[model samples]
Target: MRGRLIGQTVAVMAVGLLAAAIDGCSRRVTPEDFAEGEGATAPAEMSPQQERSSAQPTGAPEKAVTATDPGGNRNHQPGDKEPLEGVTESTPSAIQGGDSSPEPTTRVSRAQRTGGVAERPQGRPVQGEEQAGAVAPQVDQSQGLGDQAVEATPTVAPADAIPIDQPEERPQLAEGAAAADGTDDGRPAGASTAEPFNPLRAGRAGMGPLRSEGAGGEGHPAFRPASTEASHEGGRQSKKYDPIAENGPIFVGWPKPQLALVLTGCQNGYLEPCGCAGLDRMKGGLGRRHTFMSELRNKRSWPVVALDVGGLIKGFGRQAEMKFHTTVSAMQLMQYETIALGANDLRLPAAELLAVAAPVDGKTLFVSGNVALFKFEYGMTARYEVIRAGGRKVGVTAVLGKSFQQKINNPELEIIAPEEALAELVPVLKPQCDLLVLLAHASRDESIALGKAFPEFDVVVTAGGPAEPPLDLAHIDGTSALLVEVGQKGMYAVVLGFYQDEAVRYQRVPLDSRFPYSPDVKLLMVNYQDQLRQVGFEGLGVRPVPHSRREELGAYVGSQKCQSCHEVSYRVWRKSGHARAWRTLVHLDPPRTHDPECVSCHVVGWNPEYYYPYETGFWSEEKTPELVDVGCESCHGPGEAHVKAEMGSDLALQRKLQQAVTLTLEDAKKQQCITCHDGENSPDFKFETYWPKIEHREWEDE
Candidate 1:
């Protein structure tokens, strides 16, 4: 009884002491003690390449494809126009996909307008013509990016004269799914896949040989990104630039007080496979661009204007229709900008093009005083609209490609000349917008004629030609106009900075091997790959199947697993991105990210999927995803067959998976990256773009 009483007394005394202390303090808890957090951080941002590097090998068994290489990267002087929109008439498909002029902003007197040329109302549109919201017809370009009116039938065109626009319509995502396996089956498949890799025997997904960080786990404490984002996102950090600001107008005097400018042909027709160059299967899409632009202005940046030059693709492929659908996605990505049509611009019918571009904010501005789509014999061009870019009243006019004058066997089409149009409106358009830019489909030569015809003009971004643009300057009739080219096959991405002074310098730095790749990409690959090992790459033979076949490749399999057998070659191949290629695709943002033209090296089970990164959308259980790493079989022949080679001697093995291969180094590079990337995929694909595709053979490194 005495002990219990004493314990109660002590507790009472302690409580009393605590109460007295609290009374002496400011309060129970001052606001400073629990201040609300002012910021939040998730992790790092990685490039697509870095995103795939650390993936786990899942998917199906890889089959070496000898026929058509999806990564047939090529470069060309802005080639002839691709077909209009959608798939070929012979091929079934979905969506459709089109160029313009300037308005004067100077407050002119009503008396002057009455005395000069006929005064049209301020709101009247010029070249972006169409019956308001009609949809664009889908036109498919079959083989290469030639302007085909149909889907690919495995035929090659003569190298000389090229065909122009044709239209077709198809679903957009279907193309991404199809391109994942390099096929045109219009199947529903996820476009993501892990690169081929041989784990130290499969355990869980993504837990590669090393530990992993999330896609947002790049360990760069030094990087401080712009603190702004889009309506659908969180804060995004900006890329670090060297800070080369020379005077006021940045990026070619963009979106001047009264005028804004936009450049396109980035991925118009399809999503490229890997890089940010050209469009392929509609995979390389707005999912990222939307995210990018959303942040562009959130950082106290100015509103940007937009435009497209042309040749998103060869214009005839299975996913051609889907390419046109990009306008819908683009509208979603940009949200508030107006766009003009291009030459291949009319490949898809005009009514449909308007429908796709309708939803975004801002007034529609179609600036073209020349080139009209046919409506009976009158040349019905009274359809374009006008819009504003910064606070200034800029006008736009879209000119139809000259090919419209050639022959689709349609005589009703009476194309007007751009030269005459410029001559007639120089005085008017010059004063309307503080700055003027043209989205022309004619060759640079034609643009020069138009530029010289109107010295009042500021710039002209052009397409439609056969001569390669120079890496340095855009010379239009000897005038230092800015000319840029993002080639095809998704090879690279470039940011062209323009200054107001005549003494400007622009250099072409290929996104090839020479670039000091961001460590962010590699870090992301390592992290996510380990996290999602269940999903596979190529979607054929997954990790659980066991890649023991490699041990049966004749003398090549001299020992046990990779650590024991083919030690030297295994080590080299293991580190190479080839093995991790498919995984890279698997780890992409999604169905919207897999462009056939872009994922040449990203496909798994080449012969089986018939499409790399093979799918329009990943339909696996809702949120579950997969790793995307380069895997084992990319550079090597498929192990399934190589394992069957036990019946042959070492010589046979050499003949097949020969480390002593017959393919020359140069040949391998071409087969890998040179074809499509050169044309419209990468605007800056130089010899540098080709270098990274070529790896140093181990012996040479020695």
Candidate 2:
């Protein structure tokens, strides 16, 4: 596929060059023009005495002009028996050198010849003869298309024509040439080396090839002067992806990019995808995201402003606090400009969060419109923030959803409705900044509603709720406001390009196995983990026990143990989707099978501290291989006692096992499957639709 793609690119370039060469010969060059070295002389701009003496007599015999074809290798010289293909010799009325009887005139360009060489004087550069900073004059059809007409009338080019290609001897400095005072050579006089021209690189010069205006230049009649069209072609060549050329914004000319905003959301205290590496490595976390942002900043070298919808830390423990601090400190090094407030961060004590949220080196600001501590402290939480980026004032504000606001009841914290907060904040922020952005950590529907209500906002970035695919630039139907969202966790980052007087363009970059971890962030994670082991959760002022307190559920027995009686059922479970859920995480970078949030659905009977009930379940790899994924025990009840009772001589225990084991198909389809297959994890889940894929009850105990 790669080879085919490269071949296609080369083929396209070849065709374009062939067409350009043909266009170059639109007004053919003859040998008599080259014999006299018409195009080889210096500029024809001379005194009246010099011009009068150079004119030839009208009665002079015509010079023998050789016709060279622009075809395959071979020269077509004077008087070949077979005139060059599609070409016939003809002489001007005054000069008679060819056959007297009129021959058919073939209006063929020099490009039509199958084998012909270009005729020009030796040691003359094709592009250097034309005066720098001068436009080529319009063609005079009555005088014919050749060097004679151009030499007779010398003219200075327009101010904009070929300005950058002006010779070193020009009076004024050209647009792109080296400083006049610096060096005698046209290159920069200083020791600073000249860099290769790149359209995407900031503060660079020489965007395209220089050409004279109109069609005649340096004794060539067919060539037209370079314009924005050349710059556009140069831009297309510089980048692998040219959004402008690919049905995106149609830029009139080269426009400098102002700023690049890298956006993120819902980190959930994930230092790495999981600790595992190799094939099991998972994507995302601070390490990979930092790597992506840093690399992009270095390449573009534009002002990179990073914003997050928040939720950096997932839990309330010393580990979570340290992780949050580490993540924020790394973000500071990464040069993040602003971060919106999320409810997850508010779960921590006011003092700890305040210390962490404090401006890092007075650069990264935390913006929130509704979130406030102890009746809205100005220093802790402001209604909005105005920041100048790439010479433009940008306003940033955040609003937490009502669902999240209800989680905080402490009188020290005050949460206002997003609508109320925006009503007061929008008017002030709109007037202060060129672009206004609101971080709306709410449901998708709620975010859209906010965009419609506040058309003054230029962008709305949503966080929380079911992880959604990156959204396109969606307008409010009646307003100019646009809405977009990144998936949950730091799995994706939206890179936005801001240009002067143009709509913002964005690309959704997925932080997956393809991206590598930053060494600095990786080192930070290692140190944080080391600290975690030394001072456990209890030492960090967090409850060490699981959140779910339920203890009535039965113990899990290995699926292999069930094979003794229900051999067919075990085979069916082995082939089902549930059996390989753990491996799915293992295949992902950093292997997220160990992650509590991911493991809950992938593995059987997982119980994280924040949600769900605790039960005897798969503890670790070495201890519970059978309970690794959803097996018989996951859909049915735990089978340790049930399996033992059937094998033992206890009549009463066996009777209890029979009753507990008889779960109707409806029970499993309606409730058992829906538990883990709901939003965020599986948005398209339909229990009745999906149950048939794994339904296996053909075999039962006699």
Candidate 3:
């Protein structure tokens, strides 16, 4: 099939070239054609001295003009003057050389032949040449033969004449085709045919070459014309997804309410997006979230009550613990009234969990019904809380589901059934406030079950759902209670409005580029990085483990060692963005050089999948400067043994080492590239497109 396609493509190209050549031969020309335009009249006879005086220095090499067809008859008639010493017929084809045959057929000019403009001389024109609309000298018909008129070419070529070459000029079609202006020739309606057709000249001034959908050249994917739907789909995919626009504004048709409830959670350790892809493509950062909240409280002047359904950090480690603290601090700055714990939050040690949940200025920081730290109720967390907003008492409580309960392995933690906990708190909490809210950190079904079981609650904010939550509210099967999932990754927020007589209004707000970075949260990020730097790798619990195949394969030797034998591959890597990954981190707003989560991907020796360092992996810039930035061993196995075996006289060992280090394109697509270009960071990553940017296929072996 491929061979047939190649053959068809070549045949099509050949046909196009033939068509273009035939089009160039259609326009005929003769010596009398020069005097055919308007206002052309033959000049009166002049003496030899007057003719010499009227001639201008064109500076071009003088050549003896001759008839285009050498075999054509040149019989002298009665009134005909003899041909001038060095001049011949003034035909368009004669100015530019034509065919040597006797046939009267039109010949393509030298400019068209070379696909470029002919070199014309440059000098000042003789006086009287400046007159506008001055016509070319004409031949006298009364002479019975013809009057040979000597015409001087102008210094400045006219607009309708041959154009100067442009680097980005679009290709022009041959004469007789529908021109750039939709005429027979590419000119105005009443324009003269004085300028001979030059197919090499641009179809129009400032026009660039045509661009096709997949016209990218070498090192890019083969051309594949996209359908209209495919083109629209590609445009949509290229930009950040906007759920808000797709699902309309929540409060657009509703009147301003007395109270607005802002719900957010399931951050999964993302205080902000990685932003490595591009800020325009990034969404759901704490910086943008704060800005969104600030607009509600300050800009729109609405009374707001912010709450969270937490899954605060994704992983359990010293880094996560610190990140939890930073996230909590940022949320507190945003004035969140209450926060509920999710499964990941329960993975922390009992002491650390208590510390993070600790009250600020005698106010509760975290509220949960089923989870208990140290197997007992603590002041740090509450079973339920009633807060005042817009002169109404609003009750809030949280419960961890049985499914999430199974994931926690903390010995000091006590987990109870969500039904048992909620059954105990609902009756007491319902009457205490005008509106009861439940923060259910569970799956969608479990959340719905809780909402159905306790319809007394006005709203149930759930944890599990799509990355960008649906704008339309999900109601309990048989109650007025609304079930809401605020999505994951802190990318969006659900705002619920409370009115005296109107229906409760809901809005899903995506924390997109429209929101500016909040200075308060930005400073917290800076301080968070500072904390990471002070803690160092060990303090953050980063202990490098030995490579899984260390004994069989090898230990990592920096990319510099590979340069000795693979200079071409080394140069390719040096020019790729991977080589400057570490520098990119250094140039980040807060400089995440010290942040383990970011540094793990940017530097070598670190495990990109687990976000940690290997036994011989990069530790610090000063300690392992050679390992800075992603390098050869990032994809290939460690190179120490391979380098040694190749340098030594052990042929069998060298073969074994080389085989271990060799990475197939299939393996890279499935395992290697994805380690760093995962969905959260490089969302637009495609192996086909990305591979070409860093491809180094200089190896001899297949």
Q: What is the TM-score of each candidate against the true structure?
A: 0.42, 0.50, 0.64
What does candidate 2's lDDT look like per residue over 428-485, in tens digits? 6554456678888776557767887887776778773334322222233344444556
TM-score of 1: 0.42
Per-residue alpha-carbon lDDT of model 1 for 440-523, expressed as tens digits? 666544555555555444455555322222222233322223334433322323233221211112222122221222233333
Top model number, lDDT: 3
User: How many backbone clashes does every candidate have?
Assistant: 165, 11, 0
Which wins on TM-score, candidate 2 or candidate 3?
A: 3
Ranking by TM-score: 3, 2, 1
Candidate 1 vs 2: which has more lDDT:
2
lDDT for predicted candidate 1 compared with the true structure: 0.33
Measure candidate 2: CA RMSD: 27.2
Error of 3 at 629 (Å): 0.6
Please tell me which model should have the higher lDDT, number 2 or number 3: 3
Error of 1 at 450 (Å): 1.6
**lDDT: worst 10-residue window of model 2:** 84-93
What's the best-to-worst order under lDDT? 3, 2, 1
Full-model lDDT for every candidate: 0.33, 0.49, 0.60
Q: Which 10-residue span in candidate 3 carries the lowest summed lDDT? A: 204-213
